[model samples]
Target: MAGGGIDTRVSHRAASYEYKVTRYLIFSCIVGAVGGALFGYDLGVSGGVTSMDDFLVKFFPLVYERKHSHLKETDYCKYDNQILTLFTSSLYFAALVITFAASHLTRKKGRKASIIVGALSFLVGAIINASAQNIAMLIIGRILLGAGIGFGNQAVPLYLSEMSPAKIRGAVNQLFQFTTCAGILVANLINYFTDKVHPHGWRISLGLAALPAILMLIGGIVCPETPNSLVEQGKLEEARRVLKRVRGTDNVEAEFQDLIDASKEAQAVKDPFRNLLKRKYRPQFVIGALCIPAFQQLTGNNSILFYAPVIFQTLGFGSSSSLISSLVSSSALIVGTLVSMALVDRFGRRGFFIEAGSEMIVYMVAVAAVLAKYFGHGEELSIPIAAILVAAIFLFVFAYGRSWGPLGWLVPSELFPLEIRSSAQSVVVCVNMIFTALVAQLFLASLCHLKYGIFLLFACLIVIMCTVVYFFLPETKRVPIEEIYLLFENHWFWKNYVGQRHQDTLAEPEKLGESKPAHA
Candidate 1:
């Protein structure tokens, strides 16, 4: 089952070479990871600004008046306008579309090009948003911001993964996630104070988006291209030089040779996008390109992130206090990310996923139970109950931070071959964006209709996602990017299809039927 007349070249790259933490590697990764702030600032900023009374009154007066209605059924339904939700969801719609172009840019022009473009676009969008007086301008600005995110999301994870040695790849790549959380925290802190300033506070929150864009713009200029990318462009001497520098050694022949061979394999495939559709890649396509990113959004952590201030407002806090409440939750996200960075390499990816998934389920249920018991059609929630609700959600956010929030990006970046990496990353971002857009578009409406049951819906999604990860995703810790093929090739269910359609290799297949059992 391991082969159907297809050659298999298993790599011992990870075992053959070891890497030390080098200054260049750290600098490049930090620069690349700054891309996450562009994404995180928007996530944290949009929700807070939307919940600002002045912002809603100016841009969405219908929802604004409803917020003051004080009607029995208005608690969850106050901000449920479709057009209002568009302010948040519109960014993703634009991101999903632009990511295809970013894919080509990433593969042909290099990852840094896309990151630079993203930062530039975001900087402009921030300027427009800060000055906008109409809803049209705000939406247009969001669309531009989405374009920035599309490019950033497409390039940053792959950049981090390619630049890193296998031993510390998780921590390196997760710098993107950590920076994203950091951006969110900063945005929340800004909003907490800005909300108190009235009419122009939201503008200050919106304009500061330019700061992270500036950071990444500087970073894009500073960071070196990944050795894999250099090799892909046929800059073999440059690739060798970069590889030597990044690895901190002249003894990089083994890795350099592997990169040459992989580049040869990559060149033979005329169109990677078309090649990605081959049967041999089914496992990667289904789980990595499709399921993981989509499911990450479906876990609904962003619902809390995007509407945390709003949810707290409904629980009886003013805009400032609600922003403060979200600040606490965002702080937990940073803590969880740090915990993951410390433990992920040691504990492995799948363990963190399974453990965190279970933890999220428990917290989701706890949140739902509390809301259902004390929050009702005409009832006001007590201080104790609201505190408990926020506490449960804080733990939920922490669980998500460790597992899905970062792993969604990390796992997909791990799944693809270099030849199709850009294409696959594009798909990952598109699917993630589509789901994210849907969630952003629907969450307010769903919250109004489903009430506490909305929490239970996310819990059910967590169950399905955890099951898929258990059955389909293999542990990828410490696996070299060049060698990830073996993980799929030897996987219990994936082995059946991994190499059956690959056309570029001509070695004897591994002994058949030697794959691990399903539960292994």
Candidate 2:
């Protein structure tokens, strides 16, 4: 009878433990999603708000008058192209500066604190933007918004990676990308309605971003700190508690010990950047820090997203039609991101990169061919031809959303050890923003000068990127955080060919901190 009662108690305890873990994991992912949604909202809102007729008339009367003199007043605004460009790209400049600070903030206060700071920053920015009386005020708000993005972008992915089980880490991290798409969809929908409100409609569009920011702040308060950060801070017991809560089981001893071992190795390195350059870690730095983000930006995805309406108009669509088409393209992006979230874990990262790269090359080449043919005609093309061009652009976006959009963020988050994860991620984020700024600044100029050549340029880049992935990038699916170094240690070709199988073999009987043979 005593044995029977003890068995029942054990079963009950196991059930109760699982309940808590599942609850905590869901809560944490929701919090990360809030941060992602805010990021997406910022991206979507700016495009629509700046293009609103009332917004331009209030802010730039001279340019608005010039534009209106040429045609009937319409729903879209016209502003000085230079000023409008500044307004849109200004956020990335600020993001670059604040990302440096975010690295320190994440390390000193912990990832949760950094996330809270980001949420508050975004809230303040939203308020300022909503009440802006001049272009200068609007610019200041954008700066603040960029700062918030800088903080949250670095902290959230790192937190998610640390908290997630290895088996589902890719899917969980991809949630960041998925929520970003959701934010874009939400913002686009809001702006569609708000555009009808004259004079102050832009304010409503910009102000709505605060809702997600507020939710992120509240969620940050409720979520537990990541176990990895706790271990870094030498709070072993706290780390164990967090691991148990997040991993959904009490059998976290091995994982916690792995964290301790990895933490010690990370702490032993005094200068992460200097150490990152060492020959041993070069492959990771090359692939994670530099190549991934550089290739992601160069793909022209952001250029397409930031200037979709303009591109559509250049293709001869009317203003309203261009806006609607941009919305549809953004919807495709959301769908592609959702698909990526579902498949990233199952398909593995390298496969997606290769597939997406190949598809992007095909789509961009086709777009260039179609555009070249239209321009060759020396007259306006028929609507069917224009539709083909739009389809090509949408396909390019779909391919990007499926691969680089999420993996760019996911790869860096998983590549580094705990000691340098935040700093390394911040550096990569800064690089990403820099490239993004460059692309934003140059995209219109490229359209003017290169014409269809721009698509060809992006296509060539894909060819190079695909080659790099096939040669250097290894599969990291289900690999434990500590053992990631083994992936970089093997010969490049061997790692690429047999890396996943080796990782799977090592993962069996999951011994924590167990080192595989260097050549294995």
Candidate 3:
């Protein structure tokens, strides 16, 4: 009788664990990451398009139409440079407003719905940009594109981060950053190949982004809404069903309990945004919504990625050589993102932030010194040394790819509890987009007017970033989302959370004066 009873219990347990991995989750994340690609592609393609005088003349004919009617075609080309600068900068103008709205929209619509909305909006934006007859049309198209990107930017990470197993969360979430680099490489390649053949190649590039948008929309139709969203709607069974598939049965009930607890806390909370200001979560909230993105943009990454070809050209690389270097640089970004994924779970969050931030300071200063010495005023100091300087650009991409690039998203995802994750994510992403726009706008103007002065300014910013990270940042890896609050509530997270085996190297080793294992 005892043997029969044990067998019955085992069979029942196995039966209860039944679940299958669906294709929908994987497909949805890919589709979501594609929106990130469009943002990267558009940013990169504009760099080359901005330099094309003929394309600018054709695209923004209004500027030249009335101002210089009789000038020779060649002379008119020279006079029309002003309009292209304005055209190139229009993207930043649009992104700033759209990102703020994305937070509220995501809160109301849910992740999948917001993504579909963004994709459709992107499709319309691409059509408008492709068919633009005047600068006004172009600006409007840019705004539409910005809206789409804003929605995706906020929605993709939140969905991916939540759905992924915490064990491999960094690896899965890194896809967004990977596709971003891939898009940049694609854009750079298209620009370089079409540079001699088609000045209006930008239209082709802009239209290519629509293909991904369509796929994303289709994917959203097929994928399940996140369990978190389902729960928020009072569909507890539906949430449990989805969780069983994603998380498996080993600890399904326990995991579900945690989810339920988090949901209750979240639902009980009156205003997520206001609650973010509560003393306990406030520091993390500020770090998520402000510090992460600030660290990302202040590293001079935008200055390097967008203006690499220009900087390379100044360093005596032939136009084609500079283009090849951009390809290599983007490839390095992909590789670095992969490396970051490998170490994220191992080294923990704060370690990655501090190490990456400190290293960036070193590289940014070196890049500044190299740019000052090897190239200035559109001239090279010496061809041989300039080649070396051109190669150093890859270092910049690699540094960012490893640290600021992925961590900007990763830190916020890991730092906040389930209740405040979305609110914190929205605020941080909005801050990121705002500063990204500001930095992009200033970077170009600074390059035009300040030359090496931009690099010098970024170098100083990087140093300050390193200081900020070392003093304030907290490490978070392999810890459950709920327990993350313990970091804020407990006085000794480092000592208590970081295991004795890894104590000495931990940032706040003294926190572990008691020296317990990570989980104990």
Query: Once model 1 is optimally superposed onto the true structure by TM-score, how far is the C-alpha of residue 403 displaced, in angstroms?
Result: 1.2
Clashing pairs in 1: none
TM-score of 1: 0.90
Task: Give per-residue lDDT, candidate 1, residue 353.
Answer: 84
| Model 3 stretches astray by more than 4 angstroms | 1-21, 59-89, 244-254, 313-318, 377-382, 489-520
By summed lDDT, the worst window of 10 consecutive residues in model 2 runs over: 1-10
RMSD of each: 3.7, 7.5, 7.9
Candidate 1 lDDT, 305-405, residue by residue in tens: 99999888876666666788899999999999999888877787788888999999999999888878777565567778778887888999999998898
Q: How does candidate 3 fare on TM-score?
A: 0.82
lDDT of 3 by residue, 1-520 (tens): 1100112232234334433344645765676577668767776766655444345567656633522333322221222244455555556656567775776776666788778887888889888887777778877877787788877787777777667755455676888888887788888888787766665665776667678778777866667777777776678898888887665544466556555655676677677788677665655766676887877888888756776655554444555776777777777787888888777777766666667766766666676787666554434347666556655667767878888888887777767765666677767776787777766656655665666666778878877776666655655565444444445434334333322332222334344222222233
lDDT of 2 by residue, 1-520 (tens): 1100112232233333332347778888898899889998888777777656788788867755644443322112233266666677888888888898898888777899999999999999999999999999998998899889989988897787777765566677888888898887778777777878877888999999999999999988888999888988888898898788777778766667666766776677688777666555566778888888888899898877777765665565665676777787788888888878878767877888899889999999998898777653334458899788878877888888889888887777777755566557767898899998788777766766677898999999889988887777767766555456556545445345324434333333234222233223
Q: What is the TM-score of each candidate against the true structure?
A: 0.90, 0.84, 0.82
Error of 1 at 12 (Å): 6.2
Q: What's the candidate order when arranged by decreasing TM-score?
A: 1, 2, 3
- Which residue runs of candidate 1 sit more than 4 Å off their true CA positions? 1-23, 478-492, 495-520
Report the C-alpha displacement of residue 100, candidate 2, in angstroms.
2.0
